[model samples]
Target: MTRRLLVSYLTLAALVLLCLELPLGYVYSRAERERATNAAHEEAEAIAGYASLTLAYQHPDELSAQVTACAERIGGRVLVVDPAGALLATSHPLDAADQAALADRPEIAAALRGGNGADVRTSSIGGVNWLSVAVPVRHGATLQGAVRLIVPTGAIADDVHQVWLGLALGGAGVLVAVGTVAATLARWIGRPIRELERAARTLAGGSLTTPASVTTGPPEVRVLAATFNRTAALLEHLLASQSAFAGEASHQLKTPLAALRLRLDNLEPDVPPHLRGHLDAAMTETDRLARMVESLLALARMEETALTPEPVDLDRAAKDRVHAWGALYERHGVRLLLLGAPVGRALAVPGAVEQILDNLLSNSLRVAPAGSTVTVFRRLSGISAELHVADQGPGMTAEQRRRAFDRFWRAPDAPKGGTGLGLSLVQRLTLASGGEAVLLEAPGGGLEAVIRLQTLTPRHPGGFPLPLPRRRPMAGSKAGAGVGAG
Candidate 1:
């Protein structure tokens, strides 16, 4: 954009310089030609004074000498013509063809008819073009003949060429000067806009503190910057308010839910067997409500918290999360397996990797069939690390996976226990940590949740080698687990 702006400014500057310089150059050349012609005319008139006496008295010798002296002074040709348009004397020796042509010249004929005349025509000497001025030599009103002074037009053209060269140099200097100033001005204007673009992108990437600065540029650009700052401020305020409200509402809901669950548990001991099932269902609903509220609270906190990128031991994080859910997996008759070696550190916000893994593992354990393998794995990519949780369960279709990240959106055949916020929370948390979360079809018809995070620079020289962990199936399991090295 700055390049385009600078080019446009230079183009305009060059055009304006051309418009002014071209006509001025032409005018200077024309004036020089006219000055040369007028000077020739004046010289011709002065020579005619001396020639008139010789022509009137029929003295060819004196007239020829005077005409020769005039031609030498002007470095041109001179001729004396009689009233009948016949050449009487010449400045230099000429052939009969040239002498006859001189008498028949247009300006000489006009001069013999008792009139001063001037013309531009080819010279007889070298076939070069010349500006000729002819004046009639009159002795007290009787026209004796004409005296012609001819100067080569090449001299005038030479002078014009020099002047034009100066004009071109001067115009180029002006264009360069103006172009430099225009480029500076373009940078002055474009810098602010470029900065604004960067600030806008940063703000969109969850940094509300970044606002377009109003400084330098035209009045209109400054005004636009001010407007952008105001809009950003408004957006920041609205997001803060929403985050505050979600946190406040979730907290308010959680307290009542916990109190109600405590009261339900207290009533369970006094309840009969027929009503116990209903009470248990009520407790389950309360637990689901509690989980939903916690999820909402987590979402709210994610929006409010600013993520500072940091290096995390993703291998350790995945192993810890999978180990933490080991008891839960045993209760469900599902095999929890940790595959792949421990990967190097991944770049993410604090607690983001843990939260994402926890959500994925919890969801997988809930849906994974009996004796099915629930695998938590780590894979290394170039400058990135991928953490994956694959479950051998009734996985969703492509469309369901796409919409899985939407809050409160569940598949039609989704199990009864989920609040549908697990994947949504995972997605939001991954994005907040400057990572991406995606769902893929695992091998053998299972759903795989993959989180790709940036890898951090190594802390030690040559880096520490990470050893792969062996996969161990659950104790007393009939089916063995599948673990792939990555």
Candidate 2:
């Protein structure tokens, strides 16, 4: 915009300069030529008087001397020609071969025919241009001869050139001054807009506190900045309130959910043997409720606070998650295989990767049949990192995958004891971390969950060295008490 503004200003300046200078230059040039022509005519008339008197007596020597003296004084050339079309005398000496031709000259011919005339023509001597004037040398009733005065146009041309140079310099200086002012004005107009743009980008990056200063630039720009700052402040306040509400609601609901789960556990024992299966199902439902509440709490916590990214070794995280779920896989007779080479570090928001992996692995382990394989892989390439968990289990259909990320959505034929929030939470957490989560049809007729994130190089040599958490076996542990919800 600033460049465009400057261009517009310069274009106007150039047009104005062109309109003002072009005609003035033409007028000045013509005036200079006319002034030289008038001067040449006056000198020719003066010499013509001397020639007429001298020619009456046919005194060539005396006339030539007077003309030569006048020519030298006025910096011009003078010529005297006779009626018979012969050169009588010249102010300056001329070669005999050059002094003969005179009748064909237009100004001299006119003068010989009893007319006074003037013209601009090139001199024969050295090809320099001259303004020539001719006056008839009359002896009362008869024409004696003609006196011609030729003035070199070098001085007039120099005068016009100086005027042109001055005009050019003045125009250039005006353009430069206008350009400088245009640039300064452009900066003044663009400064506030740049600040607003920067503030917007910072807000997009999850910095809710980025300041948008509103005191500089033009009045309109200042007003715009003020409006933007107010809007951002209001938006931040509203989001903070919403996040607070979600956090408070989730936290408040967890206590009652825990109490309800405990009551279900107590009721499970008192139920009759014939009703034990139904009671166990009821206990399963209660556990699913507990898991749902926990997932909701996690979701609320994530929404409430933005996390700064850090370099995490995805390969190590995958191996650790596999190790943690190892016991459950063995109890279910499912082979948990960690495939592919170790991947480099990835930039992940706090706990985002962990939540994504935990949910995906939990879903994979829940669905994998006996003698089936649940594979966990990590890949690194060109500033990107991906984690994949694939299971040889009943995979989702196209429609199921389409709506899977919607909150609390589940397929009609989905497994029981599920809350239907895992995939949604996974997607939410991944997005929060500035990554993406995708569900794909596994190559071998199973479900594959893939997570992609930006790769980061760790500053330390050990590449974000951290302790791995201990994993308990799934069969006896309370971790896998529910079915896959995603």
Best by lDDT: 1
Per-prediction tally of clashes: 0, 1
Q: Using TM-score as the measure, which candidate wins?
A: 2
Error of 2 at 411 (Å): 3.8
Clashing residue pairs in candidate 1 (N, C-alpha, C atoms within 3 angstroms): none
Per-residue error (Å), model 2, residue 460: 22
Across 22-59, the per-residue lDDT of candidate 1 in tens digits comes to 99988998898889989999999988888887766778
Question: How does model 1 fare in lDDT?
Answer: 0.79
Q: How would you encode candidate 2's per-residue C-alpha lDDT over 1-486 as one tens digit per residue? A: 788879999999999999999999999999989888888888888888888888877788998799889889889889888886688778887777666667778888999999989988886769888888988888788888888888899889899999999999999999999999999998888878889899998777556466877788889888888888888888778877877776787788888878887887888768889999987887788788878877777877877666777877787788788899899889989888787666678888766777788888787777666677777776654456778777767777766777778878876666676678898888887787678888877664666777888777533343342322222222322111112345
For each candidate in the order shown, give its overall lDDT on alpha carbons.
0.79, 0.78
